[model samples]
Target chain A: MDKTYPSIEEAIVDVPDGAVIAIPGFFAAGVPRILLQALIKKGVKELTLACGCGPLLGATEELTQLVKNRQLKKVIDSYGLFRSATKGLQDPFEQAVRAGEIELEVYPMGTLAEKYRAAGAGIPAFYTPTGVGSIVEKNTVTNIVENRKPKETKVFDGEKYVLEYALKTDYAFIHAYMGDKEGNLVYRKTSRNFNHVMATAGKITIAEVENLMEPGEIDPDCVHTSGIYVQRVLKVPRIGFAITID
Target chain B: MAKKFEGLPREMIAMRASKEIKDGDYVNLGIGIPTLVSNWIEGKDVILQSEIGMTKTGPLAFNDDIDQDLINASCQPVTELPGIAYFDIFDSFSMIRGGYMDVIIMGALQVNGRGDYAGWANPAARGLDIGNIGGSMDLCAGATKLFLTMTHTAPDGAPKIVNEISFPLTVKGKVNMVFTDLAVIEITSEGPVLKEVYPGLTPEDIQSVTEPKLIIAPDLKEIEL
Candidate 1:
């Protein structure tokens, strides 16, 4: 726990260009929207973003907007849930691709999250039969499942070879239910995923909390994430506003 | 006897079939034509689910009164019916991953003879990329049954249903039946079993429209006029 950042933008320090980032927002809940805005103001680019679905809240949104505007370079997102009040997901991303402003890699959400978790845990990758024998398996690295005798299928084990990809991140953006002055973070249920593991997988970790409580206020059993991985914190509203209200 | 497509808009076809969806059935609507089914299948029941998260999903917002907080697992803003509840994204995905969904309806870029599907974001098609596999992969893996709704051919007359999928696949051997503009084809181990053809279209006419080999059921019916 090292919560001491006075503002969300302050927590965005140390992020570098071309960093792979993971955030906790599936469709809209638990998205660090305001912090993402601050990160946009912080100006990092060439982002490989992984999340449950689409949209980037902080600097990633800004960078995506910049990419849409031709001021930025590349973005790899598994989902195309980007919404720009000024530009829809299509126009900007397409324009960028046409103008060579960015490259997007659409991935499956569970795979993306699993990859992040694997990378955070320092495992390179694992095999999955999810996309076997289909076009989605094209160009994907193959992993062999080992269960029965390798001679049975003439492969490795009696299992088959499915594709897998590795996920590595430069920074992981997370949302917190509560934070102490020292930066220890607790998560609200369902709104939390990939945030904790993503925090560790990245070179830099940023957290946005709705409330800032004293260090001792968090009950030991209820605390989902310890504060060590969290480098900075910006306290915001209790997911009531300044967040997705739908 | 079932019906075939009747030259209706692709969206209209998907919505019309929503009538077949029963109450308390855990349904998963994939992107594209399936997304519009929500607008048509309204009633006192019929829970709508998007891969993003929300069940009882409503139409996309027309104004700012939209609740951003209320969204499907896909992240699209949606209206909720009474009795809507929230859970962990993983839990919802687990339900899908665990064979709990009763029906899954999604638009497809391509569905091969083996019933493989391609519905991930295709930047090459419409310049739109509003898809992610938050739970559909699991939904496809574990759904009780599946439905597909798309037109018979591409704008260039290329077939979307074929002997083999030419596009990248999202799931292999997962589709049950396909609902296209010209007909409804049920996928069987033997291959595509033609269930019906749209009204006014002959089997010969459909043969000319389709690139893949087709088989007519013993009791093939006409699509609704």
Candidate 2:
């Protein structure tokens, strides 16, 4: 079936309020700018943003507007409080948290990514040694907002590990280098960061591509996130970065 | 004109940190002054790993050379060397936790004599509840060797090398050495020993600022910049 949508607005039209959406981007790279702008225009409220740091300094204006508009109710990320030394201000996400407007659930960067991957792979949970003895393990429950979920800690082979549950979001907003009508995708260089895993972890994965081509256009070997995980696709004009369509 | 070195500039600390990384080492450089280690090290034999999923990262990219899509752990745009590889964050941490990294140089707020460090948060006002630990803990638990790079004292002149840390611990018994603005210290089973000091600074001077007692190394020498 053809997965292409005519406009970014139409692609994101059905995302409802309070949706847990995994936005795939690291700082500014690989952000779905047009789709995020569409969500802004849609005015969806109480969004639970499951992704990396929220709208980091120098992020595209559209993504930054999401936080500026106070649309997100919670953020599950590792670096939500990150303020670039060059940004010269407190992180907006951190400010929102301090103002008691936004809830923050910080994870170690790897655990965050693995939770998404585990969800996509149908794994219930996995244990990691990333935070065995530190405050990360000691303050685990306190860092979460409202004790939304319970984490079980266990020891194996005399080594301690914290159990991180799989994370499945209501939807995923992904940006890619190239995609076909069938929804197969490819991402460029470091831009691929979290998008590939976030796509698979979403209940409904929607992709916005810089270059939308017919089936077989993206070589089979080159596809990063396969079409099976991507349910919707839209093509937006390539902007800013130098991207070559194959 | 001959250059007169008055103090340990950030580049000097980075230069000392760079000496710990041998050629062909798979190293992960943390943010701040530790990131400058790449500038002092020559050639491409050392491969740099970033939490954002890249290996063999080259020097910082500037102006026209900057690719918005290519960035390091600090989110600063960077160029890639030949044979650079990319993976998801999962794979990146696997390499970290799996003991593939030879060295991880990071900035720290405090380091006790036991080689335990606390860098991610200050010990005040529920800081752990909101602190951004990021990958510090993971790198600490994973790296084969951990090096801390920092100034000797806080801006208020408080010593950073202490008998104990007031800040929340990032990892215990991970820091093998500390490359600071004033000295190079190795944390051994017996505790911190002063291995080298900057020019014009005596072992007694370092000891005065240091909260913990420091043992001067038998082979202690002036920092050879």
Candidate 3:
């Protein structure tokens, strides 16, 4: 019943090339940095990455490295570029897309989150009023990636909505503040962003926690992500940002 | 280069927009000038919502309080206020897309006479063939009221308030009001009505930098802080 792994490498050893993987975090906030570094070390190529931010002006070094290494074939994300205020700084991912090195699909943050939520909840598709008259609506025609086919639009009660399909990945990687041997996760503050829903949407969810606890250490009511959704857990030292690990 | 007009400062526009937020209202602030609205509503009853999954967010986190885990939609480290609650992105957007937000202040790249706006992308920006949408569309569609804060014109001095938006639309006909460096305008069925102008600038002066014809409100006066 123990889901704990001895090393980050072993936890993600089965991730194959061309795997559809979801990495949940907003900027540097809740990212599983070490696991991503492991993926970099593992040298997996042609990864189909579904993440919140892409490259993001160096806020995500590991994710950027994956793109810089030419490891990604396609990216599904909400924010594609940092929209930097400063001039002269170039993003490698943007460069890659411009050069036709990779394919990119951008979604409204809500739609992206809901797609994951739908996948985890067993819903095939849902209607939303988010992109009624924008390029987002046009994306249904422009996007050629598989499973990210043309979207369907319908009107209900005189209102227009676009139908978005669920997004399920081969693997989902998440960072947790605390986790138990049973894989129950506890995330902090805003760091909980997409990790909660992504946990259920992945075929195999792997969590890397700053603190590893015993099964009963985390109170039953306090669990953010239930152990049932997680298949592997690795303990990594908390590195970036401020806050005592205690 | 087009002629640039000197108008209100960025903070002044944010202060003017902050007037739209009433006490006890739940507000969501987009990046850029709209993010400055938080500074203006510090002690008010307004609760700031961050799309990255937080409510009742306090000011930017400083030295001791800085926790990478606690951040706003802009990814800046922020402090947690009393009674703060955190949820996942799905529930956060549900609060936004579900019409729970009383007001949302967003930044704009272009806005038309019909109140339709384009914010996420500008075909002009390099490497931005596909721009970031974030939660803007949902906020535009779901919020009870949408206010936009931006410069009166582009940095190159081109009119951003146009007869028709040329850039890609973020959401159509959703903007309720706009606070720019030059004036405060409300989008009405009649057209864009000028409510307030910067001191010493007449409606004509504001119109010079705006593409769409402006309807001057009867009570149009200098912007009062």
Candidate 4:
């Protein structure tokens, strides 16, 4: 079955308001720019964004635009704020958070990745030693939307670990280097980041690719994300957006 | 702003930290000064791993070689080396939290006497309470050895090697070694032992800048390059 979509707008057209959408990318790498642009045009409000960076500073402008448009209700992220040197240039997500317009939850990068992996793997919960003594263990207040519970801790072999639940989103937005009509995805270099796991964790995964190919074009050995996890594919022009910090 | 106290340069601290990596070791470099350690370990048997999901990463990619998709944790474009492998973030972090990394060099804001270092949150940023956690917590907690590279003192000349970390900790009692501008210190059971100091500087000088009283090593010598 071909999962190919004619347009980026059509691929993301079904995303509803107040949905938990996982956009996987690190910094500026592997971001689904066209899809995000379409998401902005869709103007879905009260979006709960699960992403690597909160609102990537000097990186993708789309996430910042989402925050600026007041479409985000909360952000579950690994990296919180990217401090801009200029006063007025602070990230819109950070500004929204400070103004109490949006909620923010931060986790250790490893734990965040494992949460998505657990969701995709059909695991309900797991334990980790990454955030046993930090604020991540302490900030466990129950919320209305996502029941933020206090993390449970246990000891194994005399080492302490904190219990973390799996994170499953309503939709996963992924950017890929190449995707087959069958939805098989191939990620390039470090751009792989959270895309592979997020694909599996979403109820419906939409992929925007730089190159669209036939089912047999991508070798089975090279497929980073199996087509079984992906639901829709849209081919977009390549966007060069890597931050160079000298 | 010029630092009030002079010691080894940032590159020197990274160079000294690089000495700790043995051949065939897998090293992960955090942002800032620790990222410089990559420059010193070139051609060595050590494999540099970027927490974003890459191993055997080469130096920063320059003109013509730059690939937007290939980058380090710092988000700077990077080059891939021979035998380089890439995976998803889950497997990458599994390699970190699974105790597979040999050494992880990181930057810190404050490190107390008990080996607890605070690197993620900066309470000082205007109106911002939380800072980026990134992969620091996992790298520090899961790596076989954690080598912290930072200035001996904060920009205001306040001792960063303090009696207690003022900022929220990344982890407690995980730092194995500290390479600062003024000295190379090892966090031992006995406490932080001053192993080496910048050439021509005395233990008294380092002690003055450090908030925690240090145990001078009997075999202390000038920091070797």
Give the chain A TM-score for each candidate. Answer: 0.76, 0.89, 0.91, 0.91
As for candidate 4, its clashing pairs are none
Q: Per-prediction DockQ scores?
A: 0.27, 0.47, 0.63, 0.62
lDDT, candidate 3, A191-229, per-residue tens: 789898989999999999999999888988999999999
Q: What would the per-residue lDDT of candidate 1 be over residues A1-246, giving only the tens digit for each residue?
A: 446677665577677776666766654556777666665676776665556565453224444565653434444445544433234434545555544345555455556655666676778776654445443355421111121112111124663444454676677787877877666777653355445656666667777788888888877676656777677777777544333311
- Docking category for candidate 1? acceptable
Error of 3 at B97 (Å): 0.2
Candidate 3, position A76, lDDT: 83
Superposition-based RMSD of candidate 3 using all C-alpha atoms, in angstroms: 2.8
On a 0 to 100 scale, what is the lDDT of residue A145 in model 1?
16
lDDT of 2 by residue, B130-205 (tens): 6666788788878799999998887767788998788877888878999888899999999899999988989998
Higher-scoring candidate on lDDT, 1 or 4: 4
> Per-residue lDDT tens digits of candidate 1, residues B149-179?
8987776677788776655567888898888
Best-to-worst ranking by lDDT: 3, 4, 2, 1
Per-residue alpha-carbon lDDT of model 4 for A1-246, expressed as tens digits?
899999877788889999998888887777766777888999999998887653244244776788778888987877756634244236566667767678777788899898899999999999899976777676652122254556678899998988888999999999999999999999988788999989999999999999999989888898989999999998888876647421
TM-score of chain A of 3: 0.91
Which segments of candidate 2 are over 4 A away from where they belong? Answer: A53-55, A58-60, A84-92, A141-151, A241-246, B1-6, B123-129
Cα error of candidate 3 at position A10, Å: 1.4
Worst 10 residues of 4 chain A by lDDT: A140-149
lDDT of 3: 0.84
The TM-score that candidate 2 achieves is: 0.92
State residue A2's C-alpha deviation in candidate 3, in Å. Answer: 0.6
Indicate the worst ten consecutive residues by lDDT in candidate 1 chain B: B126-135
Candidate 2: Cα lDDT at B148: 93
